[model samples]
Target: MNSPLTIGVFDSGFGGLTVLRALLPLIPGARYLYLGDTARLPYGSKSRETIARYALSSGRFLLEQGAEHLVVACNTATALALEDLKADLPIPVTGVIAPGAAAAQAVGAAGHVLVLATTATVQSGAYTRALEARGLAATEKACPLLVPLVEEGWLEATPETIAVTAEVLRIYLAEAMAEAPQATSLLLGCTHYPLLKPLIEETLRRLDYPLRLIDSADATAQAVAGQIGTRAAVGVATSTAFYATDSIEKFQRLGSRFLGQVLPPVSLIDLGG
Candidate 1:
């Protein structure tokens, strides 16, 4: 209903900041309402029904805050609850999986694409189906522990984290090799995975297989931009704001890790309201 438009970005925690960073630059004048459900984060391990309820509450809160559009930036939530939330919300809603899937298809076909996401996302098989729909082979692996490791700010070194990452990667690589010998691309299916790119790259190098990594944040940003149209002039206030279901301090601190800077002040809102 507004001219410049305010985009609502929802995440289980800090990960959505990655999506926000990409979308902000693309739509310069567009304001954004970033809602991080940090109090009840790590949606990856949650049940589908729980995730759907949380996502719906988050979307509804954004709508009440005057959001023009919604971006479900959490892969777990997107994988488990996007469709139901979209049906419940009045505004247009977009999720991260389709954009990532589409980007994987654009990279190439025939070669296998390995998807690294949370357990729930992998369990949903959204990436596999989306890629198969485009005639590409996809292999999905769930790195369930990665989310906690990331939330702890151990992107580089944590022996246990490193061990878990290595083991999970080894399994994915072995599976990919067995299924499709030509797999050359890896999709960072979860928004939080990009933060561990350096460690992941190191692991791949040690394995002697250099695979191209796709950041779903970039794809989802592009999708949001395309949906909202081109950028407008700077200084024109778009209706963007920030909201969180829990601690604003924790959200701001961790969010900077993803977005590369401290985000604008975030307001706390109880979605149950």
Candidate 2:
């Protein structure tokens, strides 16, 4: 019998679990190997060379685990090191940026496409370039706090936590809208932001901002499905392996929030800083 298809996903931290969550339904019956380089995370603050080196290491580790294709699920890694990864890795590679921009373009987001991403991703201008390359105007907002709020399990834990997160979303949305009043699409450029989608929609409604939301995680999953085709659906059951460079307990604990399901046993691995 043929072996099950294996797809590898790499992220600086467990935020990429959101991408994996998006992939579960779209590309069922495939083995997933996910690596969260938690030890050396915050890839956003690192230099380009350092980020590329880290990404390549993570990609190669997944390939060694029998991954046939790789997904760079972190926006910072995708923005900084996707090209390097594609060039060095033998397997097909996908990132969260281009697919998102294409998704926005497909929805006829022509006048202005607002991007909500990490400060590093915004500084890289990756989303802006991708959107404009497709003839869509791009406006990127650096939402640095959203990641922490999501990671902290503040999405609706309590009235106080929910209010804090909602207020932050309200402030960010208000600021972003002030800059791109004509924005027709608001792209969630960070993987962690998917957890806040409902709240974001609600906040948008509260603020009377009607920009369509574009989730990069879902878009990337669809792109992966399109690339791998139906062969990925051959197996009877889908399996996933989780790995983290540091803090296996923390990875499993916080990762479930992003993945929207209980995570299985996670292995600890070291890739060296």
Candidate 3:
């Protein structure tokens, strides 16, 4: 019998749970190890160097856990450190950006696409370049606060969060629309941003902009399936294990919110080595 194929997934915080949620259903019968660096959450505000260092440590930790493949699920880490991590790691590694960019371009609409993500991701201009590479112009805005808001477990009908999200969306949408009236597609660039999608859609509705929201989670999952060549039969694990560098309680709490269910037993691991 073949050994079960295991995939390792890492994120700066709870955001990557969004990707894992989408992936598990798509590729059932696969073993997964998810690590959330909740201790050092919010890679968005950190410097490129710091983000890279943290991501490397997390990725290495996953590798040590016997991961056959690596998925960098955090947009900030994908933007700033994926390449370096890929080079350093022995297994095939993937990031969410390329799949997302490919999906956005496949829309093929001649309009500005807006990307909302972390400051680190936005500053890297990764999404902008990815879109433009496929001949689609993109406008990216960094919503550094939204992640924290989502982590706080505020998902619905919060006036304060809605107002803040609206304000941020307004700035980006206004700029994109002014530059091109055809701008109609908005990509949720960060994994965490999907949690706020309802509020964002409502806000856009008020602004009279009929925007199509694109989430890279599904696309990223498909990409992983392709990379791993899903023909390899793997054992179906009913419960996926979780690991965190920080508070397992916080990870479980935020992860459940993102995944829409309570996460299974999450163990704490020290990746500081």
Best by TM-score: 2
Q: What TM-score against the true fold does each predicted structure earn?
A: 0.89, 0.97, 0.91
Cα deviation of 265, candidate 2, in Å = 0.5
Residue-by-residue lDDT tens digits, candidate 3, 167-197: 7656766665666566668888998877877
Q: Stretches of candidate 2 above 4 Å error?
A: 233-235
**Lowest lDDT block of 10, candidate 3:** 230-239
What's model 2's TM-score? 0.97
Worst 10 residues of 1 by lDDT: 231-240
Each model's lDDT comes to 0.82, 0.93, 0.82
Backbone clashes in each candidate structure, one number apiece? 3, 0, 0
lDDT of 1 by residue, 108-185 (tens): 744578888888898999999888888888888776777777777655467776676667656666665566557788
lDDT of 2 by residue, 1-273 (tens): 457789999999988998899898887789999999999978888998999999999999999999999999999999999999999999999999999999999889966899999999999999999998999999999999998888888887899999999999999999999998999899999998998999999999989998899999999999999999867545468899999999999999998888879999999998998
lDDT of 2 at 60: 98
In model 1, which residue pairs have backbone atoms overlapping below 3 Å?
A: 31-240, 32-240, 32-241
Error of 3 at 25 (Å): 0.9
Query: Cα lDDT for residue 265, model 2?
Result: 96
